[model samples]
Target chain A: MSTQTVGTAYRPSLGKRVQGWLAGRFAMIVAVLVLLYLFLPVFYTFIFSFNDYRKSNIEWRGFTLKHWANPCGAAGACDSLVTSLEIGLLSTLVATMLGTLVAFALVRHRFRGRGASNILVFVPMATPEIVLGASLLTIFVNGFTQLNGWFGTDLKLGFWTITIAHIMFCISFVVVSVKARLQSLDPRLEEAAQDLYAGPAETFWKITFPLVLPGIVGAALLAFSLSFDDFIITSFVSGNETTFPKFVYVSYLRGIPAQANVIGFSMFVIALALVIIGQIVGNARKK
Target chain B: MSALAHMGGGGAPATAMPPKEPSGRSWLPYLLLLPGVLWLLVFFIYPLAQLFAVSLYSDYPDYPGYYYQDVNWHNYVRALTDFLPHFGRSMLYAGLATFFAFVLAYPLAYAMAFKAGKWRGIMMILVIAPFFTSFILRTIAWRQILADEGPVAWVLEHLHLLSFMPNGRITETWVAVVAGLTYNFLPFMVLPIYASLERADPRVIEAGGDLYANGFTTFRTVTLPMSMPGVIAGTLLTFIPAAGDYVNAELLGSDTGTKMVGNVIESQFFKVLGGYPIAAALSFSLMALILAMVFLYVRRYGTEELL
Candidate 1:
């Protein structure tokens, strides 16, 4: 190191120094530009939230805060937001529960058909959303018709169908996320608990559950976001129900409302806050 | 929960186990797996099977929503013959988008992994923050950005680059759709490549320099090969979704000419009467094609564990 420093101190040429500096800053420059590219749309969305547009939101009008203050000024926007929220929460809860159990089964317990289970979990993720949505619609239509024929009952496609489809797609993502966390856990922690005379239930409730909670929470958040942001799948199964993305899609043909941008920015803010809080809490726990 | 106890203690020595085996509770694994497996079976597997069967059905001549199971298999032939151009367009657009995403994402991911130092966390947050917003909203934002009088077009016109474009604009063209896809799926490419690059040892890279290789040579031989897994994963993720996506095309591309297979499947499913068999067949074929491509790709570049 001393020899190298001495050599560099004696023979530092302008070309070499510039080359070294360029080499050092090259990746950083590219990263910042890439980040700007990524956030350009986000910046647009946030900026346009305040655009005072009458009908067509495609052009930049003068700015105002009315849209932000009255986000639900547009009809069906708030209702669709609520519908998306309901589906997100419900699907997240169900997918997280079922996926966590399946993840635990796959990671901790030896079982038959594990291969099949793994393949089943991965297929939904690998398949395209359009395919999944179309197939589910076919099944729902056929199944509901058969049921209506037999029991003289009318089961229509709406909220429940959308929720079911959301849960179905969300489960694979949940399992993948939670199973990663489960597999990464050190088995020695459970062994340590057992060595301390903690029974299985006690050990699980006290030790395993706490360790796995973060993964489950993360999975739930992922599932919720996925459910909320879905357009293609929900479009097929949601008969007349307008979720947030569905609302946005319809509004796109016309002009999207500034109120929609307000909602979009609001969601971005809430998600950022949650992520920051998660990071802070994580750091505090580490300390 | 004795089965839990037994499994928990199974890691210990034989003498540490209880003499009585929990034989009666051996079904716990299956019990734990029941709900998820059943859900997948009913919602995913069953629906796919139904879709395949529906694909074989023939629509009644005069009935709108009525169909008979024909097993004629002509649906596939007709779908392929009619929508073959769309299939090619989807692949072309997705491939171009994936390639461009890689070009943009590689340096960003590299900087995040190795050069960000104290700002890595901030960079990661920035990468994920855009994704948290509604996807449709972001695509809509792209419409504004790529509009005829938008900033992009203004800059292009000022720079004399507009003449090179087909119609002196970006929107309502394949360019806009490809750009939208690349922008939307950029993070998917970046994250995996970042992960693999982050896992690569700095010492191994430095060794290339020690062995008299220059920086570019070292990067090409060492860094590129080391990051291939991530590149493969990223490309697959971006390409798969881009190929299947209709949102970008619907929002940005020309309504009539630039339609992809996804748009066709979507329109058939929702708009046209007696469009179920054709849509189902198209979807089935798309899935089969994707699966085949992925299988070949993984065989060529991916590790067994990835599969």
Candidate 2:
């Protein structure tokens, strides 16, 4: 792998060596700058969680631990966070299950509309959130009204509606992630299991399920994140309900409380910890 | 069960069993697919059709909502005429942000893919870590950073760069919105490009150099072409979301001039009463336009695998 001339024992000139060295350093410098740019806002959000501002969280007020000490001090912020968590968990469960099933069906056993189903799965992922939200709103509003007219029962838009929207969107992402994993699987392992007199069910449970478990877990994680971080679609369908993002949007018009920053930074730290742990475990397994 | 029995016969190895045919009688795949497809049918496909129908409805002047008339086309015309500026702004901002994201992401992705060596995992964690924070909070941080009295404006003012800026500020300007878009979506651009570049054979790149091509020349000929699929995916991911994003504009841009089509649709649906038909029309039009553009772009630059 060495670029040095083997026979001639030739060495590059000082200027050439320096140029080569700089060229390598240049990529590193650009990468550092880009990474810095990406983290600037995150850094700001983390640091400002300690700000002791009375009114606005925008300025560099004197530092204090009051925000973190009472993270739920802001009236509706923690409630909204809880709501988001609930929606995220419920949607992740539903989406992961349904999406994994569809993914298995697509990758393992093909049906008549498999190609069309693939396209159908992708449509939700590709369509803009605004369009998705607006379209879903039309359905809910019209459908709910018709139901009310027919049954004299009120079906309101709230947690259930937002959860549904989240699941609808999260399904596509889960399907894609799980499908990739399923496609990459070695089919021979299943055959080998079957050759050992294992029933199809036993083979699947012993071989295929364990292998695809990581994919399913990864997909579930992705679905949870997508559901948690959703804003626009949740906004459209979440009538008279506030999720974390909705709380931030409404609070932004005024100065957001530092407690919100506390929540944001805490979430970031938790997610970072989870990722690092996942990576360590992944690397450990590889070893 | 029969297939399992056949495989267990021990006369022939189970490994030699041909892949299952698609026409097999097992209904398991269909059963598995049922819930997911049904969910999509009810929420995604059905809503899309309802949206189209709503788009054709006419607004009842005295009422809070619209009534469905048969296939009224004037809603599309009115949306086009009235909100043309917002549509144009959305495309312009999204395009500019995509370009900026590409410029920033390419080198970072390249370094991670080719030069980071053992630091790749840590570097990837850094790239994705910001996304764990709430997107709204990140943009809100940008609002603070780009505020007129904030550090960015102060530095620009002192450095004499504010002369070109409208009203000598970054907040409430298209610059802030675009910057937010670029920053927020940079990870989307980086990850895919990095994936493609990381998969590229190092020997192929070395072969380019072995042919007496300079670094830049080798990159232009070999690396860039191999990474086109990633580039295409990244651009589409960034542009589509950026175009549809109203968060940046709402948070950073002034209410008067910086409205994007997303903002228009949002306000139409949530803020203005009896604006449902117009909003639906706008949504339909935007979807159609984006789909058409994506189709054309994909046809031009995409590989079959990408499709």
Candidate 3:
């Protein structure tokens, strides 16, 4: 209770202050433990990836890169990785473009059923993935069969359907993220450009577009990551196309794959760095 | 709805128009919104409707065509009975996990918002950073830590601390699923609770202390009342997703009895001989159930602040 002390003067005794400081920091310890809990699986898989034998069962049969080098050693590991990337990239493009357009429309214009339109993304979010998955599969099955089913539809499961489904879900994330930003932006900027004799298209490209450009880019990355990361929805519509997570889920039954860790670590590191950089750059730009 | 309703109220028209339709330039918004609208319609609404259609027209297993004919709501009836246990399990698990998440998130959120002056940003960042990777990847990581041979079980078993967890096997169990849900949803809880806890000043507690109240009494009197909104938000965030999640079950839970309604629906669609109509019906029911739960939640606890 001394006035001479800086922050601790009014508090209890010195021991109590020390205890209070430790108590205040107790949350940090829990936060750290949580971080560890969340990432523990990734660390586990990453470490296990180095094990020599395929069925090392994570007992760790000494360190080795046999899994990464021998993708076939991990059973369809290589093919699935490539397939995931292809679908992820295609889905990302569709989602980003469509989402951005939707964001622009809502932010800039007032069409019929605008309220209904805003609720559209919420529908997808609210609907269970199983429902979404089955229905999409049904539509695709019926539509594809009608188009080529006399030829048997060739829909044993592959990339196109998978990509479409991924795009569908990924677009929602993009739309939501971009829409929030577009709402915050001064819509007046576009009007100013228009008043300056700039055409609507030109004004959009020059002024309105640049404002939320970061959000669009960020949303694109988010879409890509989401599309890349999906499992349940992707698994349903995927007749044959195997994305990374899907591959992991399937192989999980046949016994864990060592390459899973390698893939997981690579993806984890890249995604983390992208997010960190985006946040850093975003903060800097704001400043 | 509030979001879309508020648009275009204050914005000046951005496009210069030609003669007669000068005011009609507002249609530009429609043009902009068109693509997003169509995308949602085709991807979201239409598919959902299609799902409903399938639920109403379930084909028996081994039926030839992709989906069979004639409307039949019997699938919903069957799903109700057959999957009732799984649904119950989901609710229980989700409810328990949410309860625990709130408990753990409270202290951490309190620290971040009220105590950790400088470390707040770094701690929040750390909390959310794992989200950068796909959730599936992160959840998959749990597989390793909980494996029969992993450290968790090994440590417990080796330390003779397996009283509650005999032999300390972690994977392929409800505990794993709950752990996964709790771990993944921690931040959702923490952020909201943090926001709520931040609203209360230290002075409030000090006031209670001045009145001769102990720490517990002060916290109960002053801290808990104002943080209810955050508590609500955090609980909702953790509970909803945990209930709907299939990944945690697929990764951590045992096959029998552990399969949630999510897994059941997934089985209908992809793995087990899919019944699109039946699956659709199941999905619709799930949607209805969730909405009902939310509705009840709103009634019991005000909805305006939970979000």
Candidate 4:
């Protein structure tokens, strides 16, 4: 140790010192630049929300807050927003429920077909979104016609179809998130509960469920965000129904409205707020 | 639940799994797994089968939206012959995007993992913040930023770099499409690398330094290898989505020149008369190509940590 200390005690030359300094700060500099690149579009969206343009919101004309105040002024923007929220909420609920159960099973039980279950969760994630969308569209386009033929029922591709697709993809992510949490939990905690004479249902409800609630909440948030922000799959399955992203895209050819920007940026802010609050609560609970 | 309790206290070796429960409630695992598994089986697995069947159906003569059941091998032949350029462009663009995203993400992820310290949590949130906004909106913003009248073009024109761009334009070019792919998928590359790096043992790295190794040598030998699993996972995630994306090309690239396979599939499915079989065939081809590439990649550089 003394020899090593003495060896490094020799002062570095100017070039070596300069090289060392550059090496140390290099990651920090690159990180800041990358962060700027990541936020470029977000900054544009926020700035455009206040644009006072006559026709298109593409070019910056003058700055005003009217669009933010009247975000629903444009025709179908709010309707599409409502549709997205409904789909996001409904899909999040169903995916979370189904995914949590699967997570518990995979983490706790040694069952037949366990290997197959893991692969089933993995394949959807590995397949490209375009493929998923195309396949679902094919199934619905053909299946709906058959149903309409046989049962005198009019089955169509719209809200339900979009929601079903959302749930399909969201389940994999929910499983991953919840499974990570379940795996990290100490089995000893459950053993302690059993030693205290708690019933099986009582142990689950009073101990395990409370401990895992945060993970479930996080998974639900992720599922909702994914469902809301999706475009490619929804564009295919949402036959006549328009979601927020679809509305933004369809309007782009004719120039997007500033109100669309307003709603989009507002969602960003709301989501950020929710995440920050969650982090603070989590930290407080930990301490 | 009793099964869980007994397994922990059975005094069996830790490596051994618990014996199967004899209770009537042994069906719980299947019950718990049934709903989500059935959903995936119905929507994901069944839809792919339906798409394969659709890909084989031939179009009815002189009918725009009508098809007849037939074993049509011609659809695959036509897909490969007609859209070969699109398939090539998709691979090239997605490959370039994945490479560039890795170059751009690595340093940021490294800093967040080792440096940043107290600022790590905030940086993590910032990394995910862009996802809260609509991706289409973000891609359109890139279009505006790269437009002829935008700041980028104006600055480039003043700096004599405008001559490098074809027709003195950036917006409707391959560069714009590739840039959009890299930007949209950058976070997917970052988070995984950051995660693996964060989980790496710092003591192992410190040992390299203590052995009188130079910093670069230490990093190459120890740190980079530690993060390989994340790199593989990140590349796969970025590559798959970027290859399948069409919005960037549609919004930012030229309609005639820069279209990828995704654009061809989208248009064929929606626009062309009697285009269903060809589109389905094209989609199947893309999936097969991606799966093959992934298999080759994992065979070469896979880690057991990957799902």
Candidate 5:
């Protein structure tokens, strides 16, 4: 379109022409710069993954692959990473199941108190993590003890508390994502299945479930990421247990070991590879 | 088999006029909803109620970590009186970050929506790929990238841009905190805006060009208005998390001056012995404040629909 204007009979001033040229490319230029800005820290993390720093991973010491070879060489890095994965997996599984059911109920069937249910799902997402964490801590500390009135019966703030908190938050995200996918679906497809003599159970299993599987998978992935990346709420409820983020944060006072960087970068690469593979599989199915 | 045949006959008529509310086994929805609602009521709703109760509890004078049930409202008073500045800083920093994120994200989202064409999927992957890394690691990376002796500071110093800075450094300042907030939540802003813009009809935008109005005018009047829902959703998403965040401030900013409400809540809960009541009070206050602001903001500028 811009090319069509070139070499036209009427010509604007040089300043106007320059302004027009810039205006044409403005969005792309800003997009490229913003993309660079977004990746700046990521690049830094990747580059420093090879740093051979005895004390700190901050400075670019001469490069070495030893950290990459033994990513768990840092004192508690691997332990914390394993703990985070356990919590993340447990929370994601529970949250995805609960959330997907709720999403189906809301989208597929009408019920009393539907609006109230929506608000319940939304309020958790709107509330800050600090508030959620603090509230949960208070409950664990005194609320449960008051209920049971039994010494040593109160829930301890540790692995269970952290997993519970992660599930509590992750449910909202899963519900929202799955609800969106369910809403966008064409009801006619299900109707078509019914018209072909499939019963409710068969139609659901064969038709609706397959269509909604992508949304469920996406929601599960979202839940896992939210649980895994969470630090604030986990920090509050994790009394003695340390997660990966918490370890990195506490270790920051003393310079972080390069192993932390190595692990972080590896996770990034792994997730990216998984997403690309999923896309390829999806494209192949389409073809 | 007979019941199935009858149901199949009923389904054909229903398709011509799609039912607004699909009638099925009445018990099924309730069954599906029961477990999730129970979990939420126990964990989320009940915990909030307990927090409110704890906020009103009086401290047991001799015991530092223990408190008794009492209707002592003074915790709110103490939280407000002591940590007003932290709240103020949180709002200010979060607002600035939201504004900067909007500015930076709008163009990128716009480009991805209209200009990327074949590269749109890859662009999306690129935007979201950063989330795969630990946010703390990324923020700390910013500390290294923008170190006082780093190239950014060096270039700024040579360009005379360092005059505006209080101590001629970027690492240990509010600027760094705001930058980190903006950086961390940039994807939240971008995704919603891109989704809305991508849904928009390209012909509508071309119609603006078809008319006498120029590019900027068309955008101001047409494109921006169409994407207002996205803008509202994006701003709320970015601002809410950024406002409550402490990690960026703790990692990037100085110790005292840049502390936010989250930091105060964290320390009050974790560090201070008899700080539970006050921390709970502060948490309630922050939630109420954010909810009220969100209510008013939505009432004023909200679209008919949002995620």
Candidate 6:
């Protein structure tokens, strides 16, 4: 149809032009739907969080600041937020450091059984979170026998435990993220630094280390998000301790408070904003 | 230089190559390696070993070493019971999920990679934007969206497709779990496919077209074969864990039959009738299985990025 009278038709035949216009318009409609699917829930969560709904979710029941403003508010969103923050930061630090070094080892060294080492490092990546959580719990129980009695329960599950669990899985993400960057690094830079009589430490610090820092930073951020978002592993290892995800889990079943929506939406916005900022920074860096 | 000088030159190779800068640390790499190795071993390998040990014998609080000495290999034998079925179910869900994800992802990835026209960054961001929210909450929302009284149902009812609105709701159904898996993993599928497709060096396709081949033949012969590596990687990434996950089962599936090896392993570690050893045994077995396949694959393909 478009070829029927192309040169003579100015902008193709009328039918062809109409079809083209409709296709473009249809594409925009689909794009809008995809964007909506991507954005709606967190937006919904954010909007609903401001609602006064307690015993019901049928309507908004008017906006209220009670959920976010209240420090304790019967369910203690504040404490869990603090707890989640503490764990995320700690886990991020540990996973980033360890993962970076692992990437370093794979990239720099001509190690024995490197392939075997890689498999072992990534095996944790394949295993499900529940399995990991369960295994960690087993380790805590069977190994840490000396310090069991806490708050009348013969088990201890809280900050330290959750952090450790987060790190175990998170380190692998860091390793993969950093390793991808490391593989692209030029060995010539290090060789040049060494030829200039720089010490090995100095060479790595000036050349190799700086080159991989962005990846490390990205991995660190990824680890933070992963740890913050984790629910299953935390639940199994947490014993009696509760993180925000867990709190949301329990709270959802009992009655999803407007605070839950508020917190969820706020998280969504921050995450989206962070991603956008990262993209802008990434683009600027590229330029 | 010193290393070469030590090749029995009878005396430091005449010119003495800068006195060899005190080979202070052949130990540095190992030192760097120590902390991570220790963390993994103590927390990961050891616990896994312990779990295997426990699986061999039942746990009793009365037992001295935290497990019974019964030595029942039957746990391995019995993992075939409901366990094997869940494994099958998990794989089925993962398979369906990955299939759907690939189907959903391919055209989008294609458009983004080859046809999106300046909106690629936005498209890429859209692919990963789901990670911004908690997966569980998303699963819950999925439940709502797919529920009988929800949006899908409402739409279906309005469309007058059924006698009385057959509720597109499949919340606790196998389909739902797979839907969640597909939703979560669609990005995984897209990035790799788009990457491979994007890297296709369009000249090859143009050359094929110039050779009198049509679009389909060009895609099949040139594009598909070239993108196989990414296809394999993406499929493996989606399929391997999809086969192991229990989150979909726990959140979306109806019966225990939907539970996968992941759920069973998790249960061994935590659920009421939990068995640590069984969990370990199962995990080790699965790990060994994955390691074997991945090991063979790496041998064949020469990269460990399959995950």
RMSD of each candidate relative to the true structure: 5.9, 6.6, 6.4, 5.2, 6.3, 8.6
Which stretches of model 3 miss by more than 4 angstroms? A1-23, A68-75, A107-112, A150-156, A186-207, A283-287, B1-22, B58-68, B106-125, B128-140, B158-161, B166-169, B187-237, B270-277, B295-307
Lowest summed lDDT across 10 adjacent residues in model 2 chain A is found at A1-10
- What residue runs in model 6 are displaced by over 4 Å at the alpha carbon? A1-36, A50-74, A146-155, A192-199, B1-25, B59-67, B159-168, B209-212, B255-257, B264-271, B274-307
DockQ of each: 0.45, 0.44, 0.32, 0.48, 0.45, 0.26
- Please give, for residues A30-136, the per-residue lDDT of candidate 2 as tens digits: 99999999889889998999888878887776989998999999999999999999999999999999999998887777557877888889777668999999999
Ranking by lDDT: 4, 2, 1, 5, 3, 6
| lDDT of the candidates, in the order given | 0.84, 0.84, 0.69, 0.86, 0.83, 0.67
Residue-level lDDT tens digits of model 5 in A1-287 = 77657745367645445535544798889999999999998888888888878677767779799999998888999999999999999999999999999988877776787778878887887788889988888788665567558665655678998998999998887887777666667888989999999998999999898988887888888888888889899888898899999999989999988888899999999998998888789889999
Two-way TM-score contest, 1 vs 5, winner: 5
Comparing 2 and 5 on lDDT, the stronger one: 2
* Candidate 4 RMSD computed on C-alpha atoms after optimal superposition onto the true structure: 5.2
- Could you give candidate 4's per-residue lDDT for residues B194-301 as a string of tens digits? 877877787887786555346666677887888887788789879999999999999999978899999999999999988999999999999999988887887799
Local error of candidate 1 at B291, Å? 1.3
Top-lDDT candidate index: 4
The per-residue C-alpha lDDT of model 3 at residue A141 equals 71
For residues B118-159, what per-residue lDDT tens digits would candidate 6 score against the true structure? 788778776666666666666666666766666666776678
Candidate number achieving the greatest TM-score relative to the actual structure: 4
TM-score of chain A in every predicted structure:
0.91, 0.91, 0.83, 0.92, 0.90, 0.82
- Would you give me the overall lDDT of model 1? 0.84
- At residue B46, give the lDDT of candidate 6: 81
Error of 5 at B7 (Å): 35
Q: Which model scores highest in DockQ?
A: 4
**Which pairs clash in model 1?**
none
Global CA lDDT computed for model 6: 0.67
TM-score of 6: 0.82
lDDT of 3 by residue, A107-182 (tens): 5555566566666755565455665676677677767778785775455446888887888877766776676566
Worst 10 residues of 5 chain B by lDDT: B1-10
Candidate 1 residues B150-199, lDDT tens each? 99989999999987875768999999999999998888788778867777
